[model samples]
Target: MNTGAVVRLTEATGVGRAVVGGKAAVLAELSVAGFAVPAGFVVTGAAPDDPELGGWMAEEAARLGGPRFAVRSSAAAEDLPDASYAGLYETRLDVPADRLAAAVRECFAAADSPRVADYRRNRGGDAAAMAVLVQVMVDAVAAGVAFTAHPLTGDRRQTVVTATQGFGEALVSGQAIGEEWLSTGHRATLSRRGPARVLTARQAEEVADLARLVAERYDGPQDVEWAIDRDGRLWLLQARPMTALPPPVSWAVPGPGLWMRNFRLGEWLPEPGTPLFATWLLPLLEAGYLDGMQATVGVRVPFRWTLVNGWYYNAPPVPSAALLVRVLRDGRRRAVTILFHALVQVGRDPAAADRAVLSALDRQWREQELPRYRRLVTVAAAEDPAADPRRLAEIVDQLGRHAGIALWYLAIVGGSAWKMEACLTRFARRHLAEVLPDADGGAQILLRGLSGAAPAFDAHAVLSADWYHPVAAELPTITAVTQSGDDRQSALAVARTAAEQRCAAALADRPRRLAQFETLLRVTQRYTVIREQQARTFTLAWPVLRRCARRLGQHLAEIGAISAIDDVFFCTRPELDTTATTDHAALTSAVAERREQWERQRRIAAPLTLGHPPRLIGDVIERTVQRARPAGTTAEHGSEVIVGHPASAGQATGPVRIITDPRDFPTFAGGDVLVARATAPAWTPLFARAAAVVTDGGTLAAHASLVAREYGIPAVVGTGNATSRLHSGQRVTVNGTDGTVTVHP
Candidate 1:
């Protein structure tokens, strides 16, 4: 194989990976593709260990104008997608021109070291064929690795860049804890640890773009190594398909107090909130929450909504000495009573202590909160922004203020449904575990649909699908699976009947127990239906709000305040509200900047709880309210299994269709297991076609759960990493009965 003396960096682009090896081949290809690469050459013939090699190599180094060089082994088997034999071979950095041959020999020798031999054998490689690369060493100011996709969430839309001062080796070799940035093409979000930064925002974004471009050409995500010289010029060092990307690790709380995402705020707005939603609506929503708490709970609950990594997280007020004092001062015995229930309650069913307060809240929602919200939404929805363009700002302002408060009421009512569910599950599990199989299904029987009938929906009007998805969402087809009059709507319906019959027969001898069970079942059933209905009703003004913003956006675009109509989502309410006198140029730049930041934030997974994790007191309140813990909400899981709450029963095996955005709705095929972070009302149409359902965030009371059971498909919810762990077209067996998903190769 001694066909050449050496291959120059540019000329090596025409050489094969077999000759120049993986690292060298990629660098050469990068140079050919017009990417900035340091001047280099690869020594290609097999006799790298020849004793007299140093003299000629030093002469060649001098010819290339190098005072120092970086010599690394580029084995044919190195940097492979299946097995990146990284660090198994030697890399000699800062080799003086006179030491080129020694560095090359060292790299060549390391290729046959015991570790490399073992790696190649384990990964089923033929014997190593090594090429040694010597490149002009970069006088790096900062250098590091960049992943074209978010390694944590497997979100390809995000690029993760890490850097440290001086050499790339310090970061890659685990010698330095440096700066980290997440980029979404247009934005670079640096993790600030100290006062100084290795790369500026613009420089980090350039690094991200470099990685993204390489991935685009290669048609897959790339693990790119890069360096920035003292001159601030970026250079591509090496690139290869990423291998064994790690699962999520850090979910440290992003804020303070008791924070959570997959509950009140996360229930619908599961993904990171857009800039407009975060900046304008979320704060207003928080204010409304405070209002609703005052109305429903009789004292203002310390509540706030925060945007962490662009995801909406709610910080529920923690009960405290101060809160107790405030509640006593306000003369709201209702707040004190609930706090007493949370603090003093200890029983087989902790939620039982709060039943009275819970009932009061339900009534408040029905009589006071729901009506006010309904009235507000009606007025907001009635205003036609198109016909009255002048009133767009007014409509937008009113919606932002009222919509948040309206949804807060929805949460208040829906929260009762969640508690009733826990109470019902606890009662069933304790008393009827033998007869009922599981508390979830036992509870499901009494809670499946509105008591006697499913509420009819005009499917077309529901999603207003023409705007988001190419195909309009459809309604689930009705089916009967019974003999004569007991015709079951689904397998679940049959199971529900069987469970109900078992419960009835089991408690027949005890009239008191039967009566109690019946009462609990009725309330749980009623709230279950109402929760879904309220969720739908509260968002009625969304179309109005979005349309008004867009109308404002059209005018903004016409006046050159933003680049596109959709960019309106990136503008703050203040900017849009004062449009006539606003600095349009400044607004345009702010919108563009916000658009990038939102994109970057959206790619990273938001922590479920931000700040110190809840302690004993918080646990007690949560346990009483939510007894059945949401499963698999941690960082670790089996290689091929995803665990979550079994929202619906009946197993099915099918290909996955993960819908992160509503635009992906059209790609869903019938019988595919629909996966998502969470589903909103607009997402319900996908249920008509999904074979089974899975969600990264949601509970048994979520849209996916209710709709899947309605559609007679299996569903699992609250597997925190389902969307990241599974990809589209991957086959999976969803055991909704056991709440386990098995990924197939």
Candidate 2:
């Protein structure tokens, strides 16, 4: 029974699941479920070199009508709901009949590989229980992998297909790029990247349709491999539950006007917001923004926002005659900062506004606005979060407004850093280009700030710096280097002093421009420090908010309405509002469903913008200023190069150390090239030890850019696909001067 047992694929029943393993059993179930599955046989409890197995395999291959066979391992540890050992075991494709035994042996032997051993140790229950599946290899002209849900965006309404001209191994192994097709309601669109069209529109739909059926059979979203043969007949090869899927979220733009996520408040929120955050904190923050606007600009833009796919998308209503009239009527006495901002917006001279706005707003913020916010946070945080709903709501509202006003203060007034830096850049490009070797990136050196560490690096002040807020470990990380702050401070002072001496020489003959240049450089440096100082405290109110949310969750869980304390985050505001009277079972089910959707949303590669794009104040300044538009790409050394925005000005060569999850922070070593999709405020400490910084997403003024500048490391930001193109341990030369990341092949 152990050496010679062999079973026909068509005859293997669902009852044979334990005997044959998940992969083989699923294929048999798919056949019974009327899905198109290629005929295959399972060698159950038999050695690959068995004498009877050789005769049985030869007989089955002849009966199966195959010019070639595929030998795949069906280990018991594979394709389980809890774990999917994808690509860990061997799958020998296009095997000849004579070599089938060898392929089978290889498949069986792969169970002992180090990769699988490591995986087993981590996941456990990997007992090397395996059954080899030998099947007739279909003559595929095109092949691909399909996800019943949009894997990247966690959009359950959309199915994604990655197809190629031949075997799917190329696409899966990253050896070749494929045509990315997205199907929504029978209509499909292909991505502009990758090769020419491989799958016809109808073929992609067919693949998606089959994938949906597979998901339906499995009662969850499925990752399925499929192939379309020369005759256009489709065959299902394998199916498994999609692993680590983000929570499902909708992408449809809510209401009208332009909407974006990575700007404004969205910049700090890198992942989908939980229900409580979206409902309670977001509105309060928005209100605070309105307050900041009123205080600084004395006008309202009537900005509104909503959660699209669990991410905030704010929209400033497009201006009409009516909107303009309302704004004029609503306008208060414009603060000095806003008055200066208007001058820049209209392309007028801003020398006068610059001097007044910078001094006036800074004094006003330090004296009145900041103190008020500090008072609000200090007072409210001291309150009991477990108080009655009304008191808790009031406390939440007060904290939210305080935090939001902090953002507008930075955007409206502290934002002068951008203008000041541009002024310095234009001056350098026109006057100091001959003196400064790297003219395009000269502004970075000038804006390294006056201090090494600002209040922005304080972990105690910004709890949301971790992104996961309540969930992240409280153990301090990245901020420990404050003890050696003097070294970092001295580095900045030296860089600034050197750049200034060069600039002073360039400004010698021209008294008018020279005086103006000094003013711009000083403010640019000061504002660089100011930006982080404000950013560090932008989420100061988050701790109190989290406590309130957890307190509510604890109450709900204790009453058996939700499964866990954190499940309260998944319930919508209205649902939570009515929780006092709502049915416990209904609320419980809603939390479970929504929690899964929120988790799935984390995987989506959210677009930078949605709806129509709007021109903002920063765009106006760029148009008015004579600036150096640095080149993003250049060929060098025949290596893979990634083009991005030049952030920090320095150069360093080292192996890449990509940190995606906060848990991976401990794995990082000193002097490595820090690679990430983006870095948050809490990620600043790593920059102290980093040789260079490379991010998939960010701008010159973003958190990563600001921190990298403070540490004086080479940085390339906004290389949209760097995380996928670059991997850990790869040697790379980061050229911050040119804004390029070059891989050493």
Candidate 3:
């Protein structure tokens, strides 16, 4: 345990947990159990002579031979009976012996990270002593992660093993590539096998046995990391308890054949009698109002993109098994942000609200009235003169276009840093799916056939003018109304008033908005029935539909189909098909010449269009909509409730940061307010340095909350956009009281 000294994993014992750490202990235990544990050494609690322990570890690694080795962290408390620090540490795979010391030091540094320190602190464990286990890297035929019980369901007597090609690190961190298995009993095995990274029956049995052995030896339910070496020998690397599951909630028993559904009605409903508004009047000059464009116009445009990119990575690798899992794990922050932004913006953006209403109505009609044909779906009585169905439909289309623009902006901005293709494809597909119905389940059919030898369907011919014709018809109307007003403020007012009137009128006859909501639900059911009936025939429709929509959008761009003539021209296809009389090159030259002339004209008109209030409004809306939402808590004060998330678990008074994006990160000083949407692993660095971590979305295990607990700081999560609710630099007391973030000035 001296400085620069190391211990082999084979020689270490469970008692070594004090000096060598848990990783080496596990390796020792596994070696004695006759597992194919690799040869490695442990750098005990002693700090090495080299300033950078990892650099020293790398030097020692060279002595052992330079090809491949695993430098893993072995904390005293990690992989114990409680709390598995699975992703909280570091491991370097395929490291050369020459770089072993450096890799080991890296793991040592990670073990002392704020997040890791916080993790240990929360568990009431010492964070001082850490052991590093360096094992000779195995040439694996397969690698995976296994659990004695269903980690997700807490179903014991079941073992889940997920295997993939490559090192065991991916499997341990849930980033494994390829086929997987969910096995039951000590002997039973379940696997899905195929030529493309599929699991065979024999391998399934072997994997199940491996899981069972780890569980049995661990003396309790355990999560195990393992690999099958090139010779088909299964090797157990590490094992620990699963701490992510929570106790099941108790609920009232329902009567036979009847089940009640619970919905967050409060979220959708406006606060009683017009919620309190805290308005900050900015300097008229600071507002920087564009000529002919109202200041409020930008505010009404939903800036959904900003929040969504909280999870956006720049330049992601190809979508492999490992990458997908990584995305899923890391992207949770983004997903939550997206959902929050959409919901919050719906309350703020008139255009978004209108679209949501239309979507609800369309869903209702499809699920209820269309299927039965005999029963007409209920409609609201309050019909505003301006809330025309045609107009609303057009508004929805315009909203979709703006949303697409936001995605485009994010993709291009981060194109150099992360993979933009997945983001683009995901956004495009999702937007398209929302508007298009699955007549024959065609979209799914097409996607499934993408990797197969499916026939080359004429997507434009099959999809256009038929399946999506109705939706397309609404787009023109959307375009027309979207640009009807000069600025965002006026356009929003127009859309909002129309929507309000319609909803109000619809509720008038029913005496309650709830009744109208019920009608909408019925319509949604009818629509689903109709779709079920149509699915049998339109199974191959989506590919064609998507192709047609893409082409149509492109065509629209060519013909200046939308108001932004310059933008449309920039997006157009280069060549247009012509009749027999035109020569190829000559015709191309003529078209190019005309395009240049049009470009010149458009440039002159650019400022005119840009100056229009609605166009300027679009720009501002994008900015606001993209901002991140921070957590907050609510405390009843007279007739008002102040809500904000408690960053530290306890109660303390402090000023809030009200951070809405990365741009605000620098403004935070130690112990200042750390308000934001949900925090991800990447955001943990800030958590250690922040006074408290308040977020708009999360539960106890949320990234910010977890770090806060480690640091013994007060943390409050799920404050429902505390950053927006509380003004920046507002002094408040955050009480992480009974899991609620109460804000008190």
The top-ranked prediction according to lDDT is 2
1-745 in candidate 1: lDDT tens per residue? 1236577778886778888898998888888889998888889755564554555566668878978898988878888888888888899999998777767778877876898888878877788678988899999988999999777566777898888888889778876665677787579865422113577788889999999999999998899999999787999998999986644334556555676677765776666666666666666666766776676557776665666666767665664789778888774776777655433441323346437555566576678766776676567666654445568767656666665666665665554565566677778777877775542444556555344334333222233211212111222322211111222244445666666777899999999998888777766666666667766666555666666767777888887878898888887766776877888888888887777666556666565556654474453333432345333223224545787777776679999888875456566777889988777665665666677899887776677777666555788887876775566777889866667888775
TM-score of 3: 0.36
Candidate 2 residue spans exceeding 4 A from truth: 1-56, 59-149, 152-250, 253-257, 332-351, 385-389, 452-456, 461-468, 471-473, 477-485, 614-628, 631-641
Residue 578 CA error for candidate 1 (Å)?
Answer: 3.9
Q: What is the lDDT of residue 430 in candidate 1?
A: 75
Report clash pairs, candidate 1: 253-610, 253-611, 254-610
Better of 2 and 3 by lDDT: 2
Q: Deviation in angstroms for 630 in model 1?
A: 12
Q: In model 2, what is the error at residue 547, expressed in angstroms?
A: 2.4
**Least lDDT summed over 10 consecutive residues: which range in candidate 3?**
273-282
- Would you estimate the TM-scores of all the predictions? 0.64, 0.74, 0.36
lDDT of 2 by residue, 1-745 (tens): 1223677777776446667878888888898788899998888655654677788788888888899988898877778877889889998999999998888878888888899999999986647568888889988888889999877666788888888887888887778767676789977665422444587678888999999989988899999999989999999999988887766655677765566565567666767787767777777788888887776777767577777777666766675788667656666435433644633631233345555565677778879988887787777767755486667767777777877888887776555555556666666777777665563347667766466334244434432422235422254554334324457657776877888888888889988878877866665677667677777767666666677767777777887878888788777767766877899899888778877777766656666556654444324212321133443434242225677767776678999887876557666777899998777766766776788999866666667777787777888876755765566877888888667887774
Candidate 1, overall lDDT? 0.69
Stretches of candidate 1 off by over 4 Å are 1-254, 337-364, 367-372, 386-390, 452-498, 618-636, 709-712
lDDT of 3 by residue, 160-243 (tens): 667667665654665433455556554533332211353455676677777677667776677777777778777777776766
What is the C-alpha local distance difference test score of each model? 0.69, 0.71, 0.43
Evaluated with TM-score, which candidate comes out highest? 2
